[model samples]
Target chain A: MTRSPFTNPYVLILPGFLLSAFIILWPLFQLGNISLSEVNRFGQIRGFAGFENYLAVFNDPDFYGALWRTLIWTFGIVIGSIGTALPIAIVLHEDFYGRGLARVIIMLPWAVSLTMTAIVWRWALSGESGMLNSALMGLGLIDTNIQWLAQSSTAFPMQILIGILVTVPFTVTIFLGGLSSIPDDLYEAARLEGANPFQLFARITLPLIRPFLNIAIVLNTIYVFNSFPIIWATTQGGPANSTDILVTYLYKLGFRFGKLGEASALSIMMFALLLFFTLIYVVLAMRGEKE
Target chain B: MKRTWLLSVAGAALLSLNATAQADTLRVTVAEYSSKTGPYFEEAATAFEAANPETDVQIEVVPWDVLLQKLTTDISGGANADLSIIGTRWLIDFVDQGIAAPFDSYMSDEFNDRFFPTFLSPSVMDDKTYGLPIAASARAMYYNKDLFEQAGISQVPNTWEDLAAAAEKIAALGDDVYGYGMQGKEIETDVYFYYAFWAYGGNLIDADGTSGLDSEAGYQAAKLYKSMIDGGLTQPGVTSNTREDVQNLFKRGKVGMMITAPFLSSQIATEAPELSYGVAAIPEGPSGARGTYGVTDSMIMFENSEVKETAWKFLDMLFEAEWRSKFTGGEGFLPVNKAVAAEPAFADNADLKAFAAVLPDARFAPVIPGWEEIAAATSDALQTIYLGDGEVEATLDGAAEKIDRILGN
Candidate 1:
């Protein structure tokens, strides 16, 4: 049947398209405009200052260090979360006793607020009174207290560890959903062909869940890239800017330093990088559709 | 025809909503000025409401970091409080933005004459009073009596040499205790150290607001802090110790001395009431200036407020001797007005008296436009020295370059 133009799915999607344009695209455009000019705390706009703000950001070592830390933050969290979550999901998918309780336990981190979790984790990770150090000390594993969040060398990994803890629950939930959707018949047929557990998982389980993994990867990347609370609560990107990520740097630039133009520029750059990674993920996923 | 009727109805509804939303109320936002669950806003609202029966005064209190975020969002969105108690260092940047109202016209001779002019000076930009100083705090030395007594110290250290000697003596107490605590975490800790450096004859910035932290005097102050840590008189964690960490140790009676504000005495009273302690002027640098960090909360009016007159009335009431003493007492802050300082409430306490005595010689942190930036860089450089990883002179030079870069020199 030939659908009327107004009744077509694409045509019906127009309102959503316009709403996204208004809510999302419009502010992005405004941010871009502000990045090229000067707007002080008073909201008064100035003529274009060319690339002075961006230049200033690039010239500062702290900003550069934060940018490097941001890259480490994004990949460390993304890879770490996905890397560990898939195996846990696989194990949990197998029929076993107390699987329901295990699933509930795995998902608990996702139910808590990020800020609340960050605060609790911060206390648990403190150098002096933290639960982790105290336990280690009681175990007689180390003689001295380790300033985990206070040292630059340890602060980044400490942040990543917290990121992974938070990210694991959400990623596991996603993986569980993906695992349930896989057709049981594929596994049965592979078994009929005398396929072992490893072969079944590698050939059948992996390919069928590729789309879900892509979604998980993309969402986790975006979430971790912009994650602020963990770093803010743990060290506030300190022990001397060692744990600073792009979002925190953007915050410091706009608020702490009152350099809104430069901060907006950094925001634009972050957006561009996110967009690039997302596009690559989407393209790869779409190519997989042909396979 | 039907769409037009719907649009007309929506417009009418919005106009009615807007009228009620724009009430004659003064809204104020404060950043983490109150303790958790403290009656900061409610008390101020009650007092402010009582003073002005016709006007409604509301206050919104938030965590300092969140408060800064909210303020930044509001200012960038062209929405802000009519009057807010903002940090003194933040006043200049907001002044440059042109949204801040200068209190020159609002300042009464009596009010202006009360505060240490230098304390209020940070709130001044281009010779205009953009804000009225409300609550002020300064960083001074706090020594633990038990630790001092244990070290066989008969008297609290009054000079740099004496302080160091005391630290060495107390370091003998072993793992659970340390002789002294100096902030080295970064940012504010560095600010604390700079005050010490300047007290010793070192200066972070020259008179023209240029970097001079690499000078010989600056090196001496930096080396002293580094040496104290190296000599085992400070906790190994001092390199990462923030105010809270230091406070924790002091509360546990683990540290002999700490450099902090009058607030430390209150902490001691609340956490370890049995602990004996005393407050003193920060030991003078070789220059003989008693350097310590000075913090002030000032009120600024938004330029676009329709009720600025009413806002000024509330602001004046906020600074009144009686009202200010009550407000500051609740928050553990010092009154900006000299009249309030003379009240028996603050005068009754010996520790409060010592804290107040230094106000005459105390100075605010560098009041440059890029003070926060310089504060972070200098603090980071100081941390490098505190960690015993770098030369004092070279670290200061690096900090100077970073500060100059920030200032666009």
Candidate 2:
């Protein structure tokens, strides 16, 4: 059929494409430019120095340490949120009293800023006068107050828990949307076939929510990988930079030390890593559905 | 319709040009020291605008923690204010990058004579004044009097040996009371260690221009703090407490003694009026050496600021004795203006007198390019040692090596 110019795909998408290019691609172009140059602390370009900044990132021991911690932090938070949120979404989906209030309560944390939540958690977890230690002591859980943010051992795990906590509300919202989309008939048909409760969940509910779970996984991975405030507000990736993930370490190198060239390089590297994981995950997810 | 839009755009442009030609907006980025900082500056700006009708002053208040990052991002984007408040230690980097404009031409002889020499000296780099000290403070030991009496401590400890004994006695009078409130976290963690390091006769940089972190003073200082932590004389969680946290404990009367800036006095005044505390010189170490940290946050002009003269006028007004007295008195900062320091509001204050008593021994942060990184490195090393995760000797040596490498650059 002869198409109108208005209906042409390229013509329809041109404005949007240009807007996004101006918004994202321009700063990206600048970042790439800075990455390849010998830049001064104020991000003023001094001269061209190809690959030197990237080489510096590869050589630093702190970069490697942060890279490893970043992997753990991302996986721990993403998986923990999903693992916790799925059951929560399932519970909320079922017919129950006060489900409306329950949903609102679950969604409340999402409304507060992450920085405020983190700051509140910091005070709650303080060593001497923390609410947590007092509660623990009142319950006789331990003889003495624990220094929660003293070092990596307790601090990293507590940070991951807080990260998981903040990520759950968003994850649960996605899950609830997926759960509601599944028709009641699907569960009934399986139930009439004499499937047990766990069997019915495995057979009907799991597959129905697969796509939403996939979306949740990819988005949460991208978000948790770059999250800053939870670690920053609590420990500032410290007790000797022991809790530093790539983002916190990136901040220190870029803002704290004013190493713009290396910071830009690290930013580009982190972007590539997230992009690679997302693409690979989507491919694997689509292939699994096909099979 | 298109013609109408074009005419409107043109009219708006002329309106803006008319506004700019009438008044210049002199923007200043201020670091928020306390809740009172913003209102104080806003009041100052209103007074400034009232007198200098051609200038409309804008004050952007940034918190202390994010001030540098904000300034860096602002500078990189060419969106920085005409003036900013920066830590004097960070002045070298600003000068090296040519981001800070020299105020030499702007400073008249009388203007130069206003500030105390000690406070003014840190901002003088390469013999050109790059900044003016806007707020100054020095560290001193604050002890809880009741706790000292209960522990039956007759005199405040003047030496390390005596201080350790006093700490033991205070710890013995325990009901969750700590003898020493040592800070092992966040900003100034390294400086907290330096009190003893300086007292034990160490330099931040050795005579040969290398880091002195691995020297006898360094080893002895770390050993002393670690021993106290092990001996349960300091706070329970050494590495968990920040300077503010320790200060909070002191205000709560849980900490027997802590070393901090003079601002803690103002904090205690309003928060705990009956805390029964006294400020004294930071205890000396062996060899009769003692030191306290002297910090000055300086007001600087940016190199790219289009409104330099008006900005200088504001600076001159700010440095005047009347304005300086109000600011210094309100913010609890030591007065950098000599005339303000002589005012009874500052001169007659007992807690301030204790802080001022040690001004001769005040060691400002070394003016170097990589000072932040060096401080971070030293702080990280100290935290590691404090946590008992790394051996003291090895950690200090490793940190010293790292600092020397940075210095070498």
Candidate 3:
């Protein structure tokens, strides 16, 4: 098994390494470089502004508002989506009538794009002709049409609900995989020990699936936070920019307004924020392993 | 030894000759709408190459969003095609970024004088021609003749009051039928609403593109829109609907009338054959103004392009009356060239004729670099007004502030 020190095993992966560097690392480096410079209308780098771009963005009210909105958007989508998904996963895990069809139907949203799903839901929730409003009125539940996506107060909730709808399928699939891996004998023992369904979920299911939940939450958080198409297609974060997430605001700065420097700074800040969340998840998981 | 040296020189010369042959070819990226006009891009390219045997032209068709992204990215990276189709609204931004090349020197005075001034004006900044209009669309009230007949109405309304009455009569048909269709979403659709609003006595900002959102006219416009929604004349999904959905509803015979761009004529004739529609000027407002917003796409050359002459030649060919009439007319694009409207294809088409007739009343969107941001803010304010949760004045005022932020005012 003796090998020459010069015959490096890593050298064999040179092509793959080169490809990764070209595609991933190079873009990251370029993104970093652009964050430090001013890109003009023609996409040429004009001058170096040091961290003035970052400083300007940090002080801008829109950026601050987007930061807040992004937090709320992430928090609402992550917590709400996972909260809805885990229960559905646990329920689908149990044998029931039409369970196969139900699983397929539940996963249907995943088959479609998040943008398409948002569009359909946007239509369904429209003030005048939306199915929800029609049904509500038909049931004598309300006499007036409710502007679900039009008001600042209702728009955020509507966005979060749509995010949850689009995200639930992925979360449920991940959790279902985790649930199936758990031995039935463990649940049976818990049941025999006088644990109820709720107790079984709390004691056995929750503990065993915590790791999966962490993965699901972190992934969903990133996807939901960075999502642009749904927000753009539906609201463009409107009704006074009340629904603007960081990504949409970033998009406005870069594309709509042509503020490349500010947009790049916003992007870097977003990366930092997401990285922070990822580190927290990793730490929690490591702590869970220790426990 | 002398013979060997002579053969080596001959091989190097042959290699240099091959490169010169390849240099004749030009690659371009254009929107799919532009491709639909002729034999796709390939056909037009073939024609261009045939006309100029020395030069070869190639075109790549891209979706609108992809085209915008590609154009921006390419320009930013100091690389771009010689020419491409871009929305007129984006012209200002592109010019500001210095990606667009001014074509004044390449354009003949006669050709420049032939265009509808507004369509040309957006492409002209600081007295320089940055682009040429490839296709243009003007918004107008498209009313369904059959729906009017069903509702016992004979004439399309010429004033706002008459229009309102017609909408009321048509809305009486059933819950599935709407008297009018308007763009109610948060993006470009809102701009359509603004056209009517401005006609009704609203102005976003002054003519100089300042903050006019909070003005009396703007308030009246917001309130008028709210009244339409509140009065039950608008469709069920009006507030959250996109332009496509509104068009679809009209084509499905669900809407009795709508304000839409001229391009919808193809769909009205093909998909909604049962519904006979007529185009009319946007009804006169309280201000006694009859107007519609004009949208156009222009052929812009990038500053970094190495093939400026080739690009200009291609654009000139695109705007040629006969070629454009055949190309844009076949693809259902409204020709931007004023002379092209007189061509047999557009002139003979009844729907296009009605649309073309409204050209005298058409106006362009305000050509400002921050127009998009202001448009978005105004749309949001309008949405809030629709909800009845925000005051028209306050919403407009807030929107004005946001507009100022975008305009750096």
Q: Highest TM-score among the candidates is held by which one?
A: 2
Q: How good is the docking of model 3, by CAPRI class?
A: acceptable
Pick by lDDT: 1 or 3, better one: 1
Ranking by TM-score: 2, 1, 3
TM-score winner, 1 or 2 = 2
Point to the candidate with the largest lDDT. Answer: 2
What TM-score, computed on C-alpha atoms, does each candidate reach? 0.93, 0.97, 0.85
For candidate 2, lDDT tens digit of each residue in B132-180?
9999999999999999999999898898778788888999987599999
DockQ of 3: 0.43
Q: Per-residue lDDT of B292-380 in model 1, one digit per residue for the tens?
A: 77788777888878788888877776677777777767667776777877888887878888877887766676666778777878777
Give candidate 2 misplaced runs (Cα > 4 Å).
B1-21
Which portion of correct inter-chain contacts appears in model 1? 0.44
The order of the candidates by DockQ, greatest first, is 2, 1, 3
Over the stretch B288-318, how does candidate 3's per-residue lDDT look in tens digits?
Answer: 8767777788888878777788877877777
Off by over 4 Å in 1: A1-5, A8-11, A41-43, B1-23, B36-38, B50-53, B110-118
Higher-ranked by lDDT: 2 or 3: 2
- Sorted on lDDT, best first, the list reads 2, 1, 3
Which regions of candidate 3 deviate over 4 angstroms? A1-25, A50-52, A55-65, A84-111, A119-159, A176-203, B1-21, B34-39, B50-56, B109-118, B147-155, B172-174, B200-209
Query: Against the true structure, whose DockQ is highest?
Result: 2
Compare candidates 1 and 3 on DockQ and give the better one: 1
Q: Give the TM-score (vs. native) of candidate 1.
A: 0.93
Model 1 residue B51 CA deviation (Å) reads: 5.2
